[model samples]
Target: MHRFANPAQFNRLADAILPWATGAFVLLLGAGLYYAFFDSPPDYQQGESVRVMYIHVPAAWMAMFTYMVMAVASFTALVWRHPLALLAGRAAAPIGAVFTALALITGMLWGKPMWGTYWVWDGRLTSVLVLLFLYLGYMALWQAIDEEEKAGRAASILALVGVVNIPIIKFSVDWWSTLHQPASVMRLDGPTIDGSMLMPLLLMAGAYQAYFAVVFLWRMKLEINRRKLAVARQVSMHAPVGAE
Candidate 1:
Protein backbone atom coordinates (compact mmCIF):
# COMPACT_ATOMS: atom_id res chain seq x y z
CA MET A 1 0.00 0.00 0.00
CA HIS A 2 2.74 2.45 0.98
CA ARG A 3 4.74 1.62 -2.13
CA PHE A 4 1.92 2.94 -4.29
CA ALA A 5 1.60 6.08 -2.17
CA ASN A 6 3.74 8.08 -4.58
CA PRO A 7 1.50 9.88 -7.07
CA ALA A 8 3.59 8.89 -10.06
CA GLN A 9 3.55 5.23 -9.11
CA PHE A 10 -0.19 5.33 -8.47
CA ASN A 11 -0.84 7.01 -11.81
CA ARG A 12 1.14 4.35 -13.62
CA LEU A 13 -0.73 1.61 -11.84
CA ALA A 14 -4.05 3.25 -12.69
CA ASP A 15 -3.10 3.54 -16.35
CA ALA A 16 -2.18 -0.12 -16.50
CA ILE A 17 -5.41 -1.31 -14.89
CA LEU A 18 -7.85 1.09 -16.56
CA PRO A 19 -7.99 -0.54 -19.98
CA TRP A 20 -8.62 -3.99 -18.55
CA ALA A 21 -11.21 -2.62 -16.14
CA THR A 22 -13.06 -0.82 -18.91
CA GLY A 23 -13.04 -3.92 -21.12
CA ALA A 24 -14.34 -6.14 -18.35
CA PHE A 25 -17.04 -3.64 -17.47
CA VAL A 26 -18.32 -3.56 -21.01
CA LEU A 27 -18.33 -7.34 -21.31
CA LEU A 28 -19.97 -7.97 -17.98
CA LEU A 29 -22.55 -5.24 -18.48
CA GLY A 30 -23.51 -6.60 -21.85
CA ALA A 31 -23.81 -10.14 -20.54
CA GLY A 32 -25.79 -9.02 -17.53
CA LEU A 33 -28.24 -7.02 -19.58
CA TYR A 34 -28.69 -9.91 -21.94
CA TYR A 35 -29.54 -12.25 -19.10
CA ALA A 36 -31.71 -9.75 -17.29
CA PHE A 37 -33.88 -8.97 -20.26
CA PHE A 38 -33.77 -12.10 -22.43
CA ASP A 39 -33.15 -15.08 -20.21
CA SER A 40 -34.36 -14.50 -16.63
CA PRO A 41 -37.90 -15.58 -15.83
CA PRO A 42 -40.39 -13.10 -14.42
CA ASP A 43 -41.59 -13.36 -10.85
CA TYR A 44 -44.62 -15.56 -10.19
CA GLN A 45 -46.50 -12.79 -8.40
CA GLN A 46 -45.17 -9.58 -9.89
CA GLY A 47 -44.94 -10.90 -13.47
CA GLU A 48 -43.32 -8.49 -15.92
CA SER A 49 -42.91 -5.76 -13.30
CA VAL A 50 -40.36 -7.92 -11.52
CA ARG A 51 -37.84 -7.18 -14.23
CA VAL A 52 -37.19 -3.84 -12.59
CA MET A 53 -35.56 -5.68 -9.71
CA TYR A 54 -32.49 -6.29 -11.82
CA ILE A 55 -31.75 -2.60 -11.80
CA HIS A 56 -33.16 -1.60 -8.42
CA VAL A 57 -31.53 -4.30 -6.29
CA PRO A 58 -28.06 -3.86 -7.77
CA ALA A 59 -28.24 -0.07 -7.48
CA ALA A 60 -29.30 -0.33 -3.87
CA TRP A 61 -26.45 -2.72 -3.17
CA MET A 62 -23.90 -0.44 -4.83
CA ALA A 63 -25.30 2.61 -3.03
CA MET A 64 -24.51 1.08 0.32
CA PHE A 65 -21.33 -0.61 -0.91
CA THR A 66 -19.90 2.68 -2.20
CA TYR A 67 -20.61 4.39 1.12
CA MET A 68 -18.78 1.63 2.95
CA VAL A 69 -15.79 2.23 0.69
CA MET A 70 -15.90 5.96 1.39
CA ALA A 71 -16.20 5.40 5.11
CA VAL A 72 -13.23 3.03 5.13
CA ALA A 73 -11.21 5.51 3.12
CA SER A 74 -12.20 8.26 5.55
CA PHE A 75 -11.05 6.09 8.46
CA THR A 76 -7.72 5.51 6.74
CA ALA A 77 -7.27 9.23 6.12
CA LEU A 78 -8.10 10.10 9.72
CA VAL A 79 -6.06 7.38 11.42
CA TRP A 80 -3.17 6.51 9.12
CA ARG A 81 -2.97 9.91 7.40
CA HIS A 82 -2.92 8.18 4.02
CA PRO A 83 -2.71 10.96 1.44
CA LEU A 84 -4.79 9.14 -1.19
CA ALA A 85 -7.49 8.07 1.20
CA LEU A 86 -9.31 11.40 1.35
CA LEU A 87 -9.15 11.69 -2.40
CA ALA A 88 -10.70 8.23 -2.67
CA GLY A 89 -13.55 9.25 -0.35
CA ARG A 90 -14.14 12.36 -2.42
CA ALA A 91 -14.03 10.41 -5.66
CA ALA A 92 -16.63 7.90 -4.44
CA ALA A 93 -19.17 10.52 -3.32
CA PRO A 94 -20.63 11.42 -6.70
CA ILE A 95 -20.70 7.81 -7.86
CA GLY A 96 -22.48 6.71 -4.71
CA ALA A 97 -24.93 9.59 -5.02
CA VAL A 98 -25.75 8.59 -8.56
CA PHE A 99 -26.27 4.98 -7.54
CA THR A 100 -28.49 6.02 -4.63
CA ALA A 101 -30.62 8.14 -6.96
CA LEU A 102 -30.92 5.20 -9.34
CA ALA A 103 -32.00 2.97 -6.49
CA LEU A 104 -34.72 5.43 -5.52
CA ILE A 105 -35.91 5.89 -9.08
CA THR A 106 -35.95 2.20 -9.86
CA GLY A 107 -37.67 1.43 -6.57
CA MET A 108 -40.38 3.90 -7.46
CA LEU A 109 -40.82 2.34 -10.86
CA TRP A 110 -40.93 -1.13 -9.33
CA GLY A 111 -43.33 -0.01 -6.61
CA LYS A 112 -45.95 1.50 -8.88
CA PRO A 113 -46.78 -1.85 -10.46
CA MET A 114 -46.66 -3.99 -7.31
CA TRP A 115 -47.51 -1.69 -4.41
CA GLY A 116 -50.03 0.55 -6.24
CA THR A 117 -47.97 3.63 -5.30
CA TYR A 118 -44.78 5.14 -6.63
CA TRP A 119 -43.56 6.31 -3.25
CA VAL A 120 -43.83 5.15 0.33
CA TRP A 121 -42.58 6.00 3.81
CA ASP A 122 -41.38 2.47 4.39
CA GLY A 123 -38.42 2.10 6.76
CA ARG A 124 -36.03 0.75 4.16
CA LEU A 125 -37.04 3.41 1.67
CA THR A 126 -36.70 6.25 4.14
CA SER A 127 -33.34 5.06 5.42
CA VAL A 128 -31.96 4.71 1.90
CA LEU A 129 -33.16 8.22 1.18
CA VAL A 130 -31.25 9.40 4.20
CA LEU A 131 -28.21 7.61 2.84
CA LEU A 132 -28.55 9.60 -0.37
CA PHE A 133 -28.63 12.85 1.59
CA LEU A 134 -25.52 11.79 3.45
CA TYR A 135 -23.71 11.36 0.14
CA LEU A 136 -24.84 14.79 -1.00
CA GLY A 137 -23.78 16.38 2.28
CA TYR A 138 -20.39 14.69 2.12
CA MET A 139 -19.77 16.03 -1.37
CA ALA A 140 -21.03 19.49 -0.45
CA LEU A 141 -18.63 19.63 2.49
CA TRP A 142 -15.69 19.15 0.17
CA GLN A 143 -16.86 21.87 -2.21
CA ALA A 144 -17.79 24.30 0.57
CA ILE A 145 -14.26 24.56 1.92
CA ASP A 146 -11.50 26.11 -0.21
CA GLU A 147 -8.52 24.53 1.51
CA GLU A 148 -8.02 20.97 0.33
CA GLU A 149 -6.72 19.57 3.61
CA LYS A 150 -9.35 21.37 5.64
CA ALA A 151 -12.11 20.15 3.34
CA GLY A 152 -10.76 16.61 3.41
CA ARG A 153 -10.70 16.60 7.21
CA ALA A 154 -14.21 18.00 7.46
CA ALA A 155 -15.58 15.62 4.88
CA SER A 156 -13.80 12.68 6.48
CA ILE A 157 -15.38 13.47 9.82
CA LEU A 158 -18.83 13.71 8.30
CA ALA A 159 -18.30 10.40 6.51
CA LEU A 160 -17.27 8.70 9.74
CA VAL A 161 -20.33 10.08 11.53
CA GLY A 162 -22.58 8.99 8.64
CA VAL A 163 -21.31 5.41 8.90
CA VAL A 164 -23.93 4.89 11.57
CA ASN A 165 -26.68 5.31 8.96
CA ILE A 166 -25.51 2.29 6.95
CA PRO A 167 -26.69 -0.33 9.44
CA ILE A 168 -29.93 1.56 9.88
CA ILE A 169 -30.51 1.28 6.17
CA LYS A 170 -29.59 -2.39 6.06
CA PHE A 171 -31.66 -3.56 9.03
CA SER A 172 -34.64 -1.28 8.60
CA VAL A 173 -36.61 -3.92 6.74
CA ASP A 174 -36.16 -6.47 9.51
CA TRP A 175 -36.60 -4.10 12.44
CA TRP A 176 -39.75 -2.36 11.26
CA SER A 177 -42.95 -3.28 9.52
CA THR A 178 -42.49 -1.92 6.05
CA LEU A 179 -43.88 -2.11 2.52
CA HIS A 180 -40.50 -3.33 1.32
CA GLN A 181 -39.70 -7.02 1.14
CA PRO A 182 -37.26 -8.62 3.53
CA ALA A 183 -33.98 -10.21 2.49
CA SER A 184 -34.50 -13.22 0.24
CA VAL A 185 -31.02 -13.72 -1.14
CA MET A 186 -29.16 -13.13 2.13
CA ARG A 187 -31.36 -15.00 4.57
CA LEU A 188 -30.09 -17.60 7.04
CA ASP A 189 -32.18 -20.31 5.37
CA GLY A 190 -30.44 -19.60 2.05
CA PRO A 191 -31.51 -17.72 -1.06
CA THR A 192 -35.21 -17.85 -1.85
CA ILE A 193 -34.70 -16.52 -5.37
CA ASP A 194 -34.38 -19.04 -8.17
CA GLY A 195 -30.99 -19.59 -9.78
CA SER A 196 -32.31 -18.22 -13.07
CA MET A 197 -32.98 -14.81 -11.53
CA LEU A 198 -30.02 -14.96 -9.16
CA MET A 199 -27.47 -15.47 -11.92
CA PRO A 200 -28.45 -12.31 -13.77
CA LEU A 201 -28.69 -10.38 -10.52
CA LEU A 202 -25.15 -11.33 -9.55
CA LEU A 203 -23.88 -10.51 -13.03
CA MET A 204 -25.46 -7.08 -12.91
CA ALA A 205 -23.85 -6.54 -9.52
CA GLY A 206 -20.46 -7.40 -10.97
CA ALA A 207 -21.01 -4.92 -13.78
CA TYR A 208 -21.96 -2.20 -11.30
CA GLN A 209 -18.85 -2.91 -9.24
CA ALA A 210 -16.64 -2.74 -12.32
CA TYR A 211 -18.25 0.51 -13.38
CA PHE A 212 -17.59 2.03 -9.96
CA ALA A 213 -13.96 0.98 -10.04
CA VAL A 214 -13.34 2.52 -13.46
CA VAL A 215 -15.06 5.79 -12.62
CA PHE A 216 -13.41 5.98 -9.17
CA LEU A 217 -9.89 5.60 -10.52
CA TRP A 218 -10.54 8.21 -13.20
CA ARG A 219 -11.86 10.68 -10.63
CA MET A 220 -8.95 10.06 -8.28
CA LYS A 221 -6.45 10.65 -11.07
CA LEU A 222 -8.12 13.91 -12.00
CA GLU A 223 -8.16 15.08 -8.38
CA ILE A 224 -4.47 14.29 -7.98
CA ASN A 225 -3.60 16.18 -11.15
CA ARG A 226 -5.69 19.15 -10.09
CA ARG A 227 -3.88 19.31 -6.76
CA LYS A 228 -0.51 19.13 -8.51
CA LEU A 229 -1.48 22.01 -10.75
CA ALA A 230 -2.61 24.07 -7.78
CA VAL A 231 0.68 23.47 -6.02
CA ALA A 232 2.66 24.44 -9.12
CA ARG A 233 0.78 27.74 -9.46
CA GLN A 234 1.27 28.52 -5.79
CA VAL A 235 5.01 27.91 -6.10
CA SER A 236 5.21 30.17 -9.14
CA MET A 237 3.38 32.96 -7.33
CA HIS A 238 5.82 32.83 -4.42
CA ALA A 239 8.95 32.62 -6.59
CA PRO A 240 11.21 35.69 -7.30
CA VAL A 241 10.15 37.62 -10.42
CA GLY A 242 13.29 36.67 -12.37
CA ALA A 243 13.69 33.20 -10.88
CA GLU A 244 13.78 30.34 -13.41
Candidate 2:
Protein backbone atom coordinates (compact mmCIF):
# COMPACT_ATOMS: atom_id res chain seq x y z
CA MET A 1 0.00 0.00 0.00
CA HIS A 2 2.84 2.42 0.90
CA ARG A 3 4.62 1.66 -2.36
CA PHE A 4 1.51 2.66 -4.33
CA ALA A 5 1.15 5.84 -2.25
CA ASN A 6 3.51 7.60 -4.65
CA PRO A 7 1.05 9.10 -7.12
CA ALA A 8 3.39 8.45 -10.09
CA GLN A 9 3.26 4.71 -9.53
CA PHE A 10 -0.47 4.84 -8.78
CA ASN A 11 -1.18 6.77 -11.95
CA ARG A 12 0.80 4.33 -14.06
CA LEU A 13 -1.16 1.40 -12.69
CA ALA A 14 -4.49 3.17 -13.05
CA ASP A 15 -3.66 4.16 -16.61
CA ALA A 16 -2.96 0.58 -17.53
CA ILE A 17 -6.11 -0.71 -15.83
CA LEU A 18 -8.57 2.04 -16.81
CA PRO A 19 -9.28 0.62 -20.25
CA TRP A 20 -9.87 -2.86 -18.93
CA ALA A 21 -12.09 -1.46 -16.16
CA THR A 22 -14.10 0.59 -18.64
CA GLY A 23 -14.66 -2.39 -20.92
CA ALA A 24 -15.72 -4.57 -18.00
CA PHE A 25 -18.14 -1.94 -16.75
CA VAL A 26 -19.75 -1.65 -20.18
CA LEU A 27 -19.95 -5.34 -20.95
CA LEU A 28 -21.17 -6.47 -17.55
CA LEU A 29 -23.90 -3.83 -17.33
CA GLY A 30 -25.05 -4.49 -20.90
CA ALA A 31 -25.33 -8.22 -20.37
CA GLY A 32 -27.00 -7.80 -16.98
CA LEU A 33 -29.58 -5.31 -18.22
CA TYR A 34 -30.44 -7.46 -21.21
CA TYR A 35 -30.91 -10.54 -19.09
CA ALA A 36 -32.85 -8.65 -16.43
CA PHE A 37 -35.38 -7.23 -18.85
CA PHE A 38 -35.68 -9.98 -21.43
CA ASP A 39 -34.72 -13.28 -19.87
CA SER A 40 -35.83 -13.15 -16.22
CA PRO A 41 -39.34 -14.34 -15.52
CA PRO A 42 -41.93 -12.02 -14.03
CA ASP A 43 -42.55 -12.55 -10.35
CA TYR A 44 -45.80 -14.39 -9.66
CA GLN A 45 -46.56 -11.95 -6.89
CA GLN A 46 -45.27 -8.55 -8.12
CA GLY A 47 -45.50 -9.30 -11.88
CA GLU A 48 -43.68 -6.99 -14.29
CA SER A 49 -42.94 -4.36 -11.66
CA VAL A 50 -40.66 -6.87 -10.00
CA ARG A 51 -38.16 -6.44 -12.82
CA VAL A 52 -37.04 -3.29 -11.10
CA MET A 53 -35.46 -5.49 -8.44
CA TYR A 54 -32.44 -6.12 -10.64
CA ILE A 55 -31.51 -2.45 -10.62
CA HIS A 56 -32.85 -1.46 -7.22
CA VAL A 57 -31.36 -4.21 -5.09
CA PRO A 58 -27.94 -3.95 -6.67
CA ALA A 59 -27.84 -0.19 -6.13
CA ALA A 60 -28.90 -0.60 -2.52
CA TRP A 61 -26.25 -3.19 -1.87
CA MET A 62 -23.51 -1.09 -3.46
CA ALA A 63 -24.66 2.00 -1.60
CA MET A 64 -24.08 0.29 1.73
CA PHE A 65 -20.91 -1.45 0.61
CA THR A 66 -19.34 1.73 -0.75
CA TYR A 67 -20.04 3.61 2.46
CA MET A 68 -18.43 0.84 4.49
CA VAL A 69 -15.36 1.01 2.29
CA MET A 70 -15.20 4.76 2.70
CA ALA A 71 -15.53 4.45 6.45
CA VAL A 72 -12.64 2.01 6.63
CA ALA A 73 -10.49 4.24 4.45
CA SER A 74 -11.35 7.22 6.60
CA PHE A 75 -10.25 5.30 9.67
CA THR A 76 -6.98 4.36 8.02
CA ALA A 77 -6.35 7.99 7.14
CA LEU A 78 -7.12 9.18 10.63
CA VAL A 79 -5.25 6.50 12.57
CA TRP A 80 -2.22 5.74 10.40
CA ARG A 81 -2.20 8.97 8.38
CA HIS A 82 -2.12 6.81 5.29
CA PRO A 83 -2.10 9.21 2.30
CA LEU A 84 -3.91 6.90 -0.12
CA ALA A 85 -6.67 6.32 2.41
CA LEU A 86 -7.65 10.00 2.43
CA LEU A 87 -7.95 9.97 -1.34
CA ALA A 88 -10.02 6.82 -1.19
CA GLY A 89 -12.60 8.47 1.10
CA ARG A 90 -12.88 11.52 -1.11
CA ALA A 91 -13.28 9.34 -4.20
CA ALA A 92 -16.02 7.25 -2.61
CA ALA A 93 -18.37 9.91 -1.18
CA PRO A 94 -20.11 11.22 -4.32
CA ILE A 95 -20.17 7.78 -5.90
CA GLY A 96 -21.75 6.29 -2.80
CA ALA A 97 -24.24 9.15 -2.65
CA VAL A 98 -25.34 8.50 -6.24
CA PHE A 99 -25.94 4.83 -5.54
CA THR A 100 -27.89 5.67 -2.39
CA ALA A 101 -30.15 7.99 -4.41
CA LEU A 102 -30.71 5.32 -7.05
CA ALA A 103 -31.70 2.83 -4.41
CA LEU A 104 -34.24 5.22 -2.89
CA ILE A 105 -35.74 6.18 -6.26
CA THR A 106 -36.07 2.64 -7.52
CA GLY A 107 -37.46 1.52 -4.19
CA MET A 108 -40.12 4.18 -4.52
CA LEU A 109 -40.97 3.07 -8.06
CA TRP A 110 -41.28 -0.53 -6.94
CA GLY A 111 -43.36 0.49 -3.93
CA LYS A 112 -46.04 2.28 -5.91
CA PRO A 113 -46.91 -0.92 -7.72
CA MET A 114 -47.06 -3.07 -4.57
CA TRP A 115 -47.29 -0.93 -1.45
CA GLY A 116 -49.44 1.81 -3.12
CA THR A 117 -47.23 4.54 -1.71
CA TYR A 118 -44.30 6.53 -3.00
CA TRP A 119 -42.69 6.71 0.42
CA VAL A 120 -42.97 5.27 3.88
CA TRP A 121 -41.31 5.74 7.24
CA ASP A 122 -40.62 2.11 7.83
CA GLY A 123 -37.57 1.28 9.96
CA ARG A 124 -35.45 -0.02 7.07
CA LEU A 125 -36.43 2.87 4.83
CA THR A 126 -35.92 5.49 7.53
CA SER A 127 -32.54 4.06 8.52
CA VAL A 128 -31.44 4.19 4.89
CA LEU A 129 -32.67 7.76 4.72
CA VAL A 130 -30.35 8.47 7.61
CA LEU A 131 -27.59 6.82 5.63
CA LEU A 132 -28.16 9.27 2.79
CA PHE A 133 -28.09 12.18 5.18
CA LEU A 134 -24.82 10.88 6.64
CA TYR A 135 -23.31 10.80 3.18
CA LEU A 136 -24.44 14.38 2.52
CA GLY A 137 -23.17 15.56 5.89
CA TYR A 138 -19.84 13.84 5.37
CA MET A 139 -19.36 15.57 2.02
CA ALA A 140 -20.48 18.90 3.48
CA LEU A 141 -17.96 18.75 6.33
CA TRP A 142 -15.12 18.02 3.92
CA GLN A 143 -16.10 21.13 1.94
CA ALA A 144 -16.76 23.32 4.96
CA ILE A 145 -13.36 23.00 6.62
CA ASP A 146 -10.83 25.05 4.66
CA GLU A 147 -7.84 23.29 6.21
CA GLU A 148 -7.32 19.90 4.61
CA GLU A 149 -6.05 18.04 7.65
CA LYS A 150 -8.78 19.38 9.90
CA ALA A 151 -11.47 18.54 7.38
CA GLY A 152 -10.26 15.00 6.86
CA ARG A 153 -9.96 14.35 10.57
CA ALA A 154 -13.41 15.71 11.34
CA ALA A 155 -15.06 13.75 8.53
CA SER A 156 -13.30 10.56 9.54
CA ILE A 157 -14.69 10.78 13.05
CA LEU A 158 -18.17 11.34 11.71
CA ALA A 159 -17.92 8.30 9.43
CA LEU A 160 -16.82 6.03 12.26
CA VAL A 161 -19.72 7.21 14.42
CA GLY A 162 -22.32 6.76 11.69
CA VAL A 163 -21.28 3.19 10.91
CA VAL A 164 -23.50 2.04 13.77
CA ASN A 165 -26.53 2.73 11.61
CA ILE A 166 -25.53 0.18 8.98
CA PRO A 167 -26.41 -2.88 11.02
CA ILE A 168 -29.70 -1.33 12.12
CA ILE A 169 -30.65 -0.83 8.49
CA LYS A 170 -29.84 -4.43 7.62
CA PHE A 171 -31.71 -5.97 10.53
CA SER A 172 -34.60 -3.54 10.97
CA VAL A 173 -37.14 -5.92 9.48
CA ASP A 174 -36.14 -8.77 11.74
CA TRP A 175 -35.99 -6.61 14.84
CA TRP A 176 -39.42 -5.16 14.26
CA SER A 177 -42.36 -5.42 11.89
CA THR A 178 -42.09 -3.32 8.68
CA LEU A 179 -43.96 -2.74 5.47
CA HIS A 180 -40.85 -3.44 3.38
CA GLN A 181 -40.45 -7.03 2.29
CA PRO A 182 -38.11 -9.22 4.31
CA ALA A 183 -34.89 -10.62 2.86
CA SER A 184 -35.82 -13.20 0.25
CA VAL A 185 -32.79 -13.11 -1.98
CA MET A 186 -30.33 -13.57 0.87
CA ARG A 187 -31.90 -15.96 3.31
CA LEU A 188 -30.62 -18.96 5.24
CA ASP A 189 -32.60 -21.26 2.95
CA GLY A 190 -30.51 -19.90 0.10
CA PRO A 191 -32.50 -17.35 -1.91
CA THR A 192 -36.20 -18.03 -1.73
CA ILE A 193 -36.36 -16.37 -5.16
CA ASP A 194 -36.31 -18.65 -8.20
CA GLY A 195 -33.08 -19.11 -10.17
CA SER A 196 -34.34 -17.25 -13.26
CA MET A 197 -34.63 -14.05 -11.22
CA LEU A 198 -31.45 -14.63 -9.26
CA MET A 199 -29.05 -14.78 -12.23
CA PRO A 200 -29.76 -11.30 -13.59
CA LEU A 201 -29.83 -9.86 -10.10
CA LEU A 202 -26.40 -11.31 -9.29
CA LEU A 203 -25.07 -10.11 -12.66
CA MET A 204 -26.33 -6.57 -12.07
CA ALA A 205 -24.73 -6.63 -8.61
CA GLY A 206 -21.41 -7.48 -10.27
CA ALA A 207 -21.93 -4.61 -12.69
CA TYR A 208 -22.47 -2.16 -9.88
CA GLN A 209 -19.26 -3.26 -8.17
CA ALA A 210 -17.37 -2.88 -11.47
CA TYR A 211 -18.82 0.58 -12.00
CA PHE A 212 -17.46 1.61 -8.59
CA ALA A 213 -13.97 0.39 -9.48
CA VAL A 214 -13.78 2.48 -12.68
CA VAL A 215 -15.10 5.66 -11.10
CA PHE A 216 -13.11 5.33 -7.86
CA LEU A 217 -9.78 5.06 -9.70
CA TRP A 218 -10.58 8.09 -11.83
CA ARG A 219 -11.56 10.20 -8.84
CA MET A 220 -8.55 9.14 -6.74
CA LYS A 221 -6.19 10.32 -9.48
CA LEU A 222 -7.87 13.71 -9.67
CA GLU A 223 -7.81 14.19 -5.89
CA ILE A 224 -4.11 13.33 -5.73
CA ASN A 225 -3.33 15.87 -8.47
CA ARG A 226 -5.28 18.58 -6.66
CA ARG A 227 -3.47 17.93 -3.39
CA LYS A 228 -0.07 17.88 -5.12
CA LEU A 229 -0.74 21.26 -6.74
CA ALA A 230 -1.65 22.76 -3.38
CA VAL A 231 1.57 21.43 -1.88
CA ALA A 232 3.66 22.87 -4.74
CA ARG A 233 2.09 26.32 -4.35
CA GLN A 234 2.76 26.30 -0.61
CA VAL A 235 6.44 25.47 -1.16
CA SER A 236 6.91 28.20 -3.79
CA MET A 237 5.34 30.83 -1.49
CA HIS A 238 7.73 29.96 1.37
CA ALA A 239 10.95 29.85 -0.70
CA PRO A 240 13.44 32.78 -0.32
CA VAL A 241 12.51 35.52 -2.81
CA GLY A 242 16.07 36.18 -4.19
CA ALA A 243 17.93 33.06 -3.09
CA GLU A 244 19.58 30.95 -5.81
Alpha-carbon runs more than 4 Å astray in model 1:
1-5, 168-191
In candidate 2, clashing pairs total 0
At residue 61, candidate 2 shows an lDDT of: 92
Best by lDDT: 1
The residue-by-residue lDDT of candidate 2 on 1-244, one tens digit each, is 2434588888999899989888988988998999999998887777899898999999999999999999999999999998878888988999999999999999889887777788866655676777899999999999999988788789988988889766766577445543445542222123388899889999899989989999999999999888888776876799798652
Q: What is the lDDT of residue 51 in candidate 1?
A: 80
Steric clashes per prediction: 0, 0
Q: What overall lDDT goes with each candidate model?
A: 0.85, 0.84
- The parts of candidate 2 lying over 4 Å away from their true place are 1-5, 168-191, 242-244
Candidate 2 C-alpha error for residue 110, in Å: 0.6
lDDT of 1 by residue, 118-211 (tens): 8866666778888999999999999999999889989999999999756766577446643345542222123388999988888899999999
